[model samples]
Target: MEASKRQETARAPALPWTVRFQIFGLVAAASVAQRLNGTVNRSFFSLVDRHVRASARPDKFGVRSDDVDVDASRGLWARVFKPSEAQSPLPVVVYFHGGGFALLSAASVPYDNMCRRFCRELGAVVLSVNYRLAPEHRYPAAYDDGVDVLGYLEKNRLQDPAVQVDLSACFVAGDSAGGNIAHHVAQRWTAAKSKSIRLAGTILVQPFFGGEERTESERRLEGVAPIVNMRRSDWSWRAFLPEGADRNHRAAHLTSENADLAEGFPPAMVVIGGFDPEKDWQRRYADLLQQKGKAVQVVEFPEAIHGFFLFPKLPDAGNLVKEIKAFMDKSKASASSA
Candidate 1:
């Protein structure tokens, strides 16, 4: 909650220099036009498209899995990752990739790296759901895909003798747009009673839940260099919704109503960026959960900006990972006790 500083040093020339350099340059460029109109968002998406395609790494961070289908109607792409250790029913995390809901896919470098880390570090099975993106798919499309996949796992495979999924310790997580999806999906799961599911928690990193106007932190950090600016946030909302859907619409804000908060809101850990325009909303949502008597852990990286969690090479990134691990550990323990 306190103001802080990021320990930024000259870009390190490291082994994965290509990936690091690309991210470094992109962040630097974004910092320059952080508040530029929609132009910066357009350029950022363009760069993301090119970078995601080129930075795809299928070999490193080895984990094993098969091409599994979650939803056929919307063409949901899924990849399962299981740890190398001999099989035990492993916890499952249904992950949604982030690209402002329109740009990147599951194969995106940052998402791929995250999926790898979750599977390897926690020894949990990860199901990365490549949900349909926006512009072509639009508002409810992403949300629908996310909920449907969770429902599918709950109904069909959670109890399947061969599934290898820890029915008692499952989770839903995503970042950015994916974080938004995780919020909605978790709500739906709780609402439906999802009898077969024993969801542990959700992880939302810098989630977007704006309703028309920017929050206090958003307004104050309007032009913070190397961070997502107000204009870019607006662009993402507009790009992800239907032609007529208003960003200010109550439905657009995940915490628009107490009813949406639901009873037994599963334990959650929401990571926010001090410089993220959406930080205030993220805090508001977490507070709402706490008010509901739900266990909520909020980790705000005061020194970092949006997407800081993606750069694992940076010192801040490494520290963020450690925080994330602690959060996950607590979540898993809470799930077991419940």
Candidate 2:
């Protein structure tokens, strides 16, 4: 009954200069195309994406990754990361990256770095999916890819001595649109009654959810947040949603009073950032899951921005990784007890 009862704002330190420079460049790519049409300038932004490279060798954190094809014909693949010094079968996190469903990939530098952190810190295996983007491969495309990866996990093994994964404690995790996709993926996976992987829980880092009517946070922080503004948010919805569909479509408008979750929907971890305009929607989603009788954990980063988990310069990013580890441990404990 009370959404405003959360933590007060606690501003993290100013972003490092290197991060500021990248943010300014990304803003250029996104801001320039607003005048032309209701679309993103992917060509310009692709330059920034080029630097999101992946390597198969172990990095400083002792995590190594390699890209594995899930379905080459459809350009569906996943970057798999695991600890180099694997001592046991670790939980597998099926990670989907954020780009408003129309941009970025698992190969992106920030995502790659984050996945490595997940592997090294949590002692887990990460399967970061490179699902197809929207305005080209719209609604259900990414969802389909998300589900298919589970099928791949069921039939395939890491086939490497260094990587040992435990599908019994699998998790669907993502940020922004990918978080939305993670929710639906879990929904679809649970609905089908597949025993391929046991979904212990889901981790939604500032999930991107919206409707035709804006929430209070959206109005209050419309331009205050650095990356997202009203224009960009609307454009992302237009590009990702089905042609001619409004924001009220089931995918975007997820917090209806009657939003139907499957009977066995797993527990969830919802991350919120005060500076994110979408913060209210994320809270509504947690409320919805609770109303539906699913267990929920809410983590607050009062002064953080959208996609803050992607950059390590922000203290909240490290804090998020620790929260994820604790959530996973709790989920596994609950599953074992159940």
Clashes of each: 1, 1
Off by over 4 Å in 2: 1-17, 33-40, 256-258
**Tens-digit lDDT string for candidate 2 (228-272):** 777788888888898999999999988645477887788999999
> lDDT at 180 for candidate 1?
85
Would you give me the overall lDDT of model 2?
Answer: 0.84
Give the whole-model CA lDDT for all candidates, comma-separated.
0.69, 0.84
- Residue pairs with colliding backbones in model 1 are 31-226
1-338 per-residue lDDT for model 1 (tens digits):
13332222112223255544666676555444333332234466556444232222334554655556776666886766665443577788898877667666676667666677777776677888888866667778888888878777767663434337776778888888788889888887787776677678888888877777666666666555343666666767776777777786543575535336657568888888665667788888788778778788888776566676677755666776677678767877866676
- The segments of candidate 1 whose C-alpha lies over 4 angstroms from its true place after superposition are 1-62, 155-163, 255-259
Cα deviation at 280, candidate 1, in Å, is: 1.4
